[model samples]
Target: MEETEAATEKAKDLIRMGVARAALLEPQDKVEVDVVPSALIIGGGIAGMTGALNLANRGFEVTLVEKEEELGGLLRYLHRIYPTQEEASDLVKAKARKIRENGNIEVLTSAIVTQVQGFFGNYDVTVKREGKDIPFKVGVIIVATGAEEFKPVGLYGYNGVNIVTQLELEVMLKAESFTRNNVVMIQCVGARDDNRNYCSRVCCMTALNNALILKERNPKAQIFVLYRDMQTYGTLFEDIYRKAREEGIVFINYSPQRLPTLDKGFVNVFDEFLGEEISLLYDLIVLSTPMIPHPDSGELAKMLKVPIDEYGFFLEAHVKLRPLDFATDGVYLCGSAHWPSTVSESIVQAYGAASRASIPMSKRRVIAEPIASVVDEEKCIGCGLCEMICPFKAIRVEEKPGGRIASTIIASCKGCGVCGAACPQQAITMRHFKDEQLLAEVMALAEGT
Candidate 1:
């Protein structure tokens, strides 16, 4: 009888504890906010236009802004595209035509985003056009500001005459002014070096493609390509590479230690395969450099409150899961703004960004997830520790009548819980994962319930 009483008392205690713990769990209500079905796409380049057209096709209004007076960024300067040898002008013209025809898209040229405020689902944007600041309310933003080509000026003794960049050479090719019988192209001129340790992904292919073009123009032109490594990974580019080899173009493997030296229409280099230093006389020396981030990328990133990589390219939310998105919700990235990309890759990324931006617009309302950070006013000491630790800048210390307190912007809080973990007074708590709720789970596990 005594044993039975003791066991029953223990059972009662466990039940009481479980009930008390269960009572501490407070269910949070979902916040529903009206969403604006409009998007702001920065940059009127190929990616920007493609993303705008795609969103407009989905019945969403779009605002496309360009820093330049016209559309077609780098594409406007290119003579022809690689592998297919298609005229870049034709492609840009078609995309521009579609953008102009799209009634839902409002194109803004010679405009810059002066200010950006608000959060996901609703953003207040200010554009400076002709010294006037125009306001725009948008649901999402896509950053497609393209990058600029690196100009290898002093490197390799580039003088814009004998040693010219690939872009300059493209212009000469278009004008039919490059009638040089002997030409030497140097790949990875301003890239894959100590300063820039990234391979210009397309420089090798560009050299080969342009070499083939030169061969087509003059069958007897002596063309040579000096490269560290050929990055013709794609099958189409590889096919072109093979065709270039078959067309009697010489490809020499060169090392950085023995980079080609230029002296008045002559280039000297040590060929790795031949194991000998050789000098060649050429009329033109084309330096195939990489595409770098735009000079204004930092300023743009600051305005958008987005993070950029060390190389000044906008950092995506995730490498695989959210390549088109920023960590901040409602903001997306595409094109060379993210990284140096080819035309096809830029177009694909633009469409992906458009699709992602259309999600909240399709739902017609933005639903806040219940998992968010909550503040306990009584325990808060107004130390501002939580505010300082928050990476999203979601928490702010406000001065109230009684004392200062840390307040959380629930819509901006991503439930990362860094603020809660960093709170000295333990005043900040993450919803659905409060201390009492977590302790209850621990107690349950301990009792083997």
Candidate 2:
């Protein structure tokens, strides 16, 4: 389709910028870019990288900015991705190679977007990279920051003793052989209860993977995975479930209705299935907790004007049709930054998201919205209320020759016209509404005057 071809061309453009950025970076700067990006992909994780690469393929110049010291996100910590159990690092390395080959994508590690303004088709993003701030004029934005695991320290006594998280287990699996002959894994330690109701999709699967590995390591090992439900949907995954049972792995039905207790050397869980209470002894306890969004998600959502679900995941406009795209036309969301997903799922989403970003490049460039806020120079009072109230931090509050003041930076303004609403002196008039034009509408809506 025409859309697909256009996407490819822009993808190439962004990749060229990537090489340029790498060469010009300063000593502390992990990466640098001078290009006015066609789209900005934030988070640099699986979703971010996939979005960047796919957008590059579509011929969009993409700037991938990550807050972490390196990329790969959660995939870096995993020993192997499940179902396939493929080497996680090898997969990440391969993606890194493709990212290098793509000439249209530029990467910035250890970078944080401090200020973002503009809307849909045109936005100004200010980022801090290596202690220096940089700004970019972008046509689109994609958020793929991903999620972090929760520490159920109290529930499972996971104080780094025998109690550990799925990630910690991965590390221990590689470091030293666990002495526990009987390992009991508890699922949903911090998810899908009254607090977090959404199923994390991958926790059950991850627990299964770990249990199977533990059993494989020691044929005499007793691996028990306790869960409310075992959701092994999709083709071939059912086979994985069957294999786990064949390997002598035991699964017990647990309840989120009551809190699970951990004693000195055993787990005291009610036998909801057997209609009684029971205690299971184990040397190690793995808490397969659900992933939670970063605590700053609320602030980030407000700053970017992005919508988030009540539970904290970035809420996408349409679950299927828009996949990575937000309800807002030019914004996109990806990975655990939005919701939980496996590396394979995240990578697929990354591709879908980045591919969607090629729209701006099809036109070669974008035009600024004319509906931005405007100051009436003569009537304007330099109180500087608009500058500070802007969530995007786009306003430039400046003093004039006298005590009088004025403001500028229209491109950074989203044309939301919240400033005009906030202005007390009524000196600011947003485009499309003049003084008389506003009065007529207000009067029409108002009760008879």
User: Which candidate's lDDT is highest?
Assistant: 1
Clashing residue pairs, backbone N/CA/C < 3 A, model 1: none
Q: For residues 352-438, what per-residue lDDT tens digits would candidate 2 score against the true structure?
A: 776666655565444545556778777777888887676544465676776566575544456777788888888787665555654
Error of 2 at 63 (Å): 3.3
Q: lDDT tens string, model 1, 1-449?
A: 37997787778767766676778877689888777999999999999999999999999999999999989998898888875678988988999999889899999999999998777887899999999999989988999999989987678878998788887877778866556789999899889888888986877877787788788889999999988999998788889888989999998889988788876667898999999988888988899999999989999887776899888989998998989989888899999999988888899999999999999889978877678898999999999988776766577789998699989876667899999888888888899788988787567656754
Best by TM-score: 1
The per-candidate count of clashes, in order, stands at: 0, 23
Model 1, C-alpha of 426: deviation from truth (Å): 5.3
